[model samples]
Target chain A: MITQQDFEQIQDAIAGKLSADEQQAYNKRLSTDSNFAEDAFLQDKLKNILSDKPFDEFRGTLMRIETEYHYLGLWRTTETSETFSIEDILAMFEPVAHYEQALSHADLRAAGTALLQPQNGSNFLPNDTLTFAWAAALTEPLVLSIENNQEDVVLQDTIETGTVSHNITLPNLPAGRYYFKLTGNNSGMYIGMFFVNKNLLDEL
Target chain B: MVTLQQTQAFMNSKHTLNSNEQEKNTRIIDGFKNNNTRIIGECYAEMYPLIVRYITNNSGDETTAKEIIWECFEVFFKNCTKPDFVLNAKFSSYIHSIANNIWLKRLRDNKKYTYTDITITESSRHDFDDDTDNPYASDIDDYTDQITETIYENDLSHVIRQLLLELTEECKTIFRLKHEEEQSHEEIASLLQISIDMSKSRLYRCSIKMAQAIKNSPYYRELIDGFPFLTNYTNKKRKS
Candidate 1:
C-alpha cells in the first residue's frame, strides 16, 4: 500500500522537481511500491491534449494525388480510365470485430486487444476504421489523364493486405489541386471523392 | 499563487497567451508549414537536443526517443497549419507530459509494465549559519521554518521546469498542456492546428518515451528497490 507521503514523493519525482538526494530517497521508496509511481490523473490530462491536435493536411492531400499514364499503346490516360479491383486490395482490409457485448464473457475475452486495434478485425462499431485495402477496394483507384494534371503521384507500393492501414508521403506538390475519380468493378462505384488540400506534414 | 484548476485550465485552453509569445510561436510554426528551412532549422536545433535527452532518460532507447520527439513536433506543426488552432499552455510542459503518457500507455498496452531503478527523496537543504547572524534571515529557525519553506518552494519549481525543458519540445508541450492547461482534445487541436487523430498518436508516442526515460534513470531503479509489487511484476516479466 502507498502511504500519502510516498504518493507525494512519487508526484515530486515525476514532476522533475526533486533534489538529487531527495530523489534518491524517493527512489528507495518507489522500489517498494512502483505501481503507485504512476499518476493516472496526470496521464489522462496529457492524453487529452495530444489527442485534440489537427490532421496533417499535406499528407492527407498527397494521399489523393493521381498520376496519368498510357497503357497497351492506347491513350487510356489515368483521368478517363475505367475502374478495376485487385486481389491485394481485397485481402488487405480486415473486417472490424463485431463484438456482441451481451454474449458470453468468453467472447469478450477473445476480443482482447482487438478493442485497442480498432482499425483491424470486423467492424463491431460504426466508428471502427477499415483497412487501406478496404479503402482502396471500396473506392477503386481513380485513373486520370496526363494533360489534366502533371503532379508526380504514383501508388508507391501495392496496398498491403490485412487490417493495418498505411500512409504514403509525397513532397513538393504545387499549390493548385483538384479531385480524383475512382473507376473499378462498377458494382459499387462513386463511394466518395477526396479533395487535394494544401496542408503539409511536419518534418519528422 | 495559481490554483491547480487554473493552471490546468491554462494548459488545456484553446487560447493561451494574448502577448508576444503567442505571435512568436505562431510565426515559427508558420515558417515550418511554409518549409522556411532557415527558421525551421533554428527551431528544430533548439528543440531536438531536449527531446533526445528526455527520451533517452525514459525507458526508450535512442531510436524510440528520436521517433517520439520527432513525431510530437511533426504532429505539432501539422496542427499549426489549421486556422482555428491557437497556442495553449506553456509549450514545454505540454510536450513533456504527452511524451511521458505515450510511453506509459505503451507499457500498459504491452502488459510489459516493469520498473527500473529511480531515486526519491524528502529533504536535502541544510543551514549552517546561526539563527541570529543573517540580516534577512527569518526570526524563527524551525526545521520546518518559513524561510526554508520559501526556498524549497521557489527552487523546486525552477529546477523542475528546467529539467522538463531539457526534454523535447513535444514532450514538454504535452506535459504542460495536460497538467498546466488541462485542455480537451478539441481545444488542443484548435490550439496546435493538428487533427485529433494526429494529436492522439503524438501523445502516445511521446509518453511512451518518457516512461522509458524514467524507468532507465538510475534513480528510478533505486526507488523501486524494495517494492514487492514492482519486484513481482519485474520478476514475472524478467528482462534479460
Candidate 2:
C-alpha cells in the first residue's frame, strides 16, 4: 500500500523537487522496486492527464467553429449552386468588434433612415468593393466618412441624394477596427462599424 | 502592412512552384502539430468545400460531409502529435483520403448504399493509396496504422472526459485550481478556506481516485490489451 508520504515522494520525484541525496535514493528504488517504479509512472501519467490544456483548447475551438458554421447556414441538405467565398468563411472566425461602445453617446440612426448592407460589426478584406445602402433618401448630399479606431478619418466621400445605395471601393488600409458614418445636412446621422483584416487575405 | 496592390503583386511574384509547395506543406504540418488555430481554420476553410463536393458526388450530403471532415481532422491532428509521424502526401490530399475512407466506410455499413453503386474515381484511388513515391510506401502504411491508433486514442480521450465528469464538484474545483489555474498549495488553501496540508492531501487523494478510475475503466483495459507496452504494471500487479 502506498502511504501519503510515499505518494508525496513519488510526486516530488516526478516534479524533480527532491534533493540530491533524495534523488539518488529515488533512482535506486525506482530501478530496484517494481511497485515504486509503477507508482511513479502512474503519477506521471496522471500529471499528463490533468494538464491536457492543449487538447482541451483545440477541441473547444473545433466545436466553436463547427457551431459557427452551422449557425451560418454553411451545412446544406441538397446540392446548391451557392458557395462561400474565402472572405465569408474567414469572417466567421474573426472576433467581433463592439463598435456600439463608440456610438453609445451618439444617435446611431436617423429619424426615418436605416443603414443596410455590411451589417454592424461586420468584417471586410482591404480593397474589397462594398455596397453601402440605406432606406431613406434625403434631398441634400450625404457626407460619408470612414474612420479608424483612433477616430482619424481615413476615407471621405460625398454621396449624391436620390440614390439610397452607393458602391465604394475601399482603399487599402491596415488591419484594424473602422467605423463609417453617414451624415445628412438636415437629416440626423447614421453610423456603423466594420473591421479590416489583411491576414486572411494574405493567407488566401 | 503592405497596400493591397503591393500584397497582390508580391504574392504573384513569390509563387515559385517547388519552394512554395514545400514551404506551404511545412507550415501546415507544423501548424497542426502545434495546434495553431489560425492554420487549422485556414485548412478548414480550404478543404471544407472540396470535401463537400466529393461527398455530394458520392450520394452524401453536407451534414455527413461535415461530420466526416471533422472526424478526419481529429485523427490527423492526433497523428501529427506522434514523434514518428510523417506526411508523405500533401496535407489536403491526406485529409481528402481520410475523408474518402470514412465516407466510403459509412456508405458500406449503411443498408441503403452499396459499395458498387458508389463511384470511386481514379484520382481519388491514387490519393487513397497516397503512394506517389515508391520510397514512401511504408510511410503510407504507417499513416493507416496511425489513423487506427488515433481512433483508439480519440475514444480513450472521450472516455477519460466522461470519467472526469464523474468526479465530485469539490474534486473538480481542486483539480482546476492546481492544474488549470496553476495555483500553489498556499493559494489553494486560502481560496478554499482550508489548511495547506489539507489542500495538498485533497489534491493527492483526488489524483489517486482518478488513477484508480482510469485503471478500472474498460477503455483502459482495451487500450492496454491492444498495446501491451503501455503498461506492464497491470500484468505484474495481477501476478503479485
lDDT of 2 by residue, B112-184 (tens): 6766886655443343333344323222333565565565556556666678899999899998898778799
**Chain A only: TM-score of every candidate?**
0.22, 0.46
> Candidate 2 clashing pairs?
none
Give the worst 10-residue stretch by lDDT in candidate 2 chain B.
B133-142
> Where does candidate 2 stray beyond 4 Å?
A1-6, A17-42, A73-204, B1-18, B33-36, B48-68, B78-88, B96-139, B142-151, B184-187, B229-240
- TM-score, per-candidate, Cα-based: 0.25, 0.56
lDDT of 1 at A201: 11
DockQ of 1: 0.02
lDDT of 1 by residue, B23-56 (tens): 7566776775775543444444444455556655
| Candidate 1 C-alpha error for residue A147, in Å | 48
Instruction: Pick the lDDT winner.
Output: 2
Residue B175 shift from truth in candidate 2, angstroms: 1.7
Evaluate residue A200 in candidate 1 and report its C-alpha lDDT on the 0 to 100 scale.
Answer: 16
| Candidate 1 accuracy as TM-score | 0.25
